[model samples]
Target: MTGNPTSRDYNKASVLDVLLSRAPLTRIELIELTGFSKSTVSRAVEELRADGCVVNGGVDEVTGRGRRSTYLDVPGTMGHVVGISFGMRTTCVLVADLRGRELRHVIVPTVDHQEVRNAAEWLVGLMAEASKSAEGPLRQVVVAVPGRVLGGTEIFGPAESMKVFAGPGLQRALADLVNAPVLLDSDANASLLEILTDDATLEDAALFSMSSSLSFASCIDRELLRRRTPAFGDIGVLFSGVGNEVLDGLLSTSGLLRFARGRGLDLERIDDLWLHPHEEVSRADVLDAFTTAMVTAVSAVAVTLDPGSVFFVGRLRPLVDEVLPEVRRRLDKSLATAPEVKAPTQVLGLSVARGAVYACLGMARDRLRDAVLEARRQGQHTEQSAPAF
Candidate 1:
């Protein structure tokens, strides 16, 4: 049976997440903040310490009673979480801890592209290298792809451009190579999640990435609004031939090629093209596209969720800055009647990889909490069921 989330599981994982995000907290503080029982909190903390997942951070000087007890800290190298972004051109591999700090990385050319065989062979080798080096075994892999994946199928899917993953058993084949649980998500979705990094304060945001190909992803109320074709945000497709069009038409590679040429860079193809946000040459072109695209994308969001901000997370930041002024100008021009679109358009690098870890780590943490809590509940039920002497 597929495991669905329980309220208890979410609560327990959230507790661990908060404790790990900041400095140590006393059992009293944890109880008050997490609304967990002192006894239950003690057990959880003890289990965390036993697993070596947490340690004594420091003692509270303000607490006058007793030893003032120490708080828990999640150290580096706690567990291995792998993030793979297989773009149109390159395969970027990053392995990190539960807190999302790097352990070892293997970033090589995208010689494989969409070919399952090519990617699987190269990735298998990379996995072996990572496994041998880590003190702990690989726990999970969160792979982000730059295409539309729907119904758990990777080939002949919504992403019409590339067909490399069209081969048989893409997920299973990769899992066989890594020997760990693997989670697959769209590059846009993964980038969006990675950039956000479980920050609940962020309610609504959209990310535009020119990694493998030009694409966008948006989240509303912190929940990813999905579709059958893994489609979240498609401003490139939407802004095509629209009013004062600035973005490349999704149906036209020539449009993207021309867009590249407009900035004085003639990239042969979108394969592994790392769109920088700061390069002066491409700055003007990117900004024009960013302005039109952001206006269209944010306009869509405005009509729906009306978010706080839109963050752009990718490799190129300076190039992104060039576009921000224009993006703001367009947003102002188009949404004159809509709610004020004042949120800054951000360009965050390597955020997608980090977000992938948080997403997967959150799941893994929830799983561990459930395993322990279920055992406790079972024990309690057994005690109540026993006959009295």
Candidate 2:
């Protein structure tokens, strides 16, 4: 109701921030940590509890008076968030709680040219299914796109199906379906967030997603560095110095499959290329070609960002072990200093989805905190206007 925040506003925000960051605290602990009076902490916690932002945890051990004190926490069940990652050939849907704990994760096949509306419809169903078992109502949604997102809505990329979900209209469509605000993030950026959230040791890193297409996301000092355009690290757009062809046209799985087809190989996809043996084009040869193409891309990134580590995700995970040594070798030759290059050992397929979940969880927490403050403010105003009888 006020144009500017008051001391009370700052207090509420502080309490919520502390509890959300380091939770499962008893009233006494919250008072000590927040430096607010016990009554202020109690009132703040009560407001948050009423707003479903905080919940009562199990009772703490008996105190000096032989009375057990109940601990309070920002329960994961208080709210739910969804993260969706769209690939050229597949889409991953993830549902998680306020605490960023994964509840459901599912991967579905997608057509490269599905209508934008059709893609959104498919995502709605997938999101519902993923959140079916979650404890609370969904609070926020984040969609990680594989292309350039201009002005926050217009997405330009080769993924034809995503055109529908490109701009503000996409957010409205998704928000209406899930009854929650939707966020859009680059898939590579989401992957970068996932790596940072999982590994605290990484202050700066580069994440390269190699699928039918290639994208790069970088982070510095635990923050996503902004690019000139929405899609900054799309390696696919770069010319590979080989004729007039782009890197995506030269090195992506789709490109390799085309090469296989041209060579009279029976491989229909990259996965098929490995499963079935071709007399003329061996898997070794295909891998060797991929390594060569990736060497150039990796070198470019290492020399530019000079990140602390380089991670390969997506379809490239299966080949990371073999690819790591080769890329490292190439980088060692090209750059004065090469970062640590390796493949993620876990969350291989769901990194982008996990990042989305984390992003949505953060949004949900902020929203819930604001709601708690508003409720408290309204309650105080009501008390102040009450007539003295």
Best by TM-score: 2
- Model 1: per-residue Cα lDDT over 219-259, one tens digit each: 77788766675443445555543445545342234454556
What C-alpha lDDT do the candidate models reach, one value each? 0.58, 0.71
| Most lDDT-accurate candidate | 2
Instruction: TM-score for candidate 1, please give it.
Output: 0.72
What clash pairs does model 2 have? 153-166, 153-167
Per-model TM-score on C-alpha atoms: 0.72, 0.83
In model 2, where do residues sit more than 4 Å from their true spots?
A: 1-3, 27-40, 60-69, 75-77, 111-113, 135-137, 160-169, 228-231, 241-245, 262-265, 276-285, 346-349, 372-389
lDDT score for residue 154 of model 2: 54
Residue 101, candidate 2: Cα error in Å is 2.8
Off by over 4 Å in 1: 1-29, 47-69, 73-78, 99-101, 131-137, 151-162, 166-168, 198-200, 229-235, 242-255, 260-290, 313-320, 337-349, 376-389
User: RMSD for each model, in Å, please?
Assistant: 6.5, 4.4
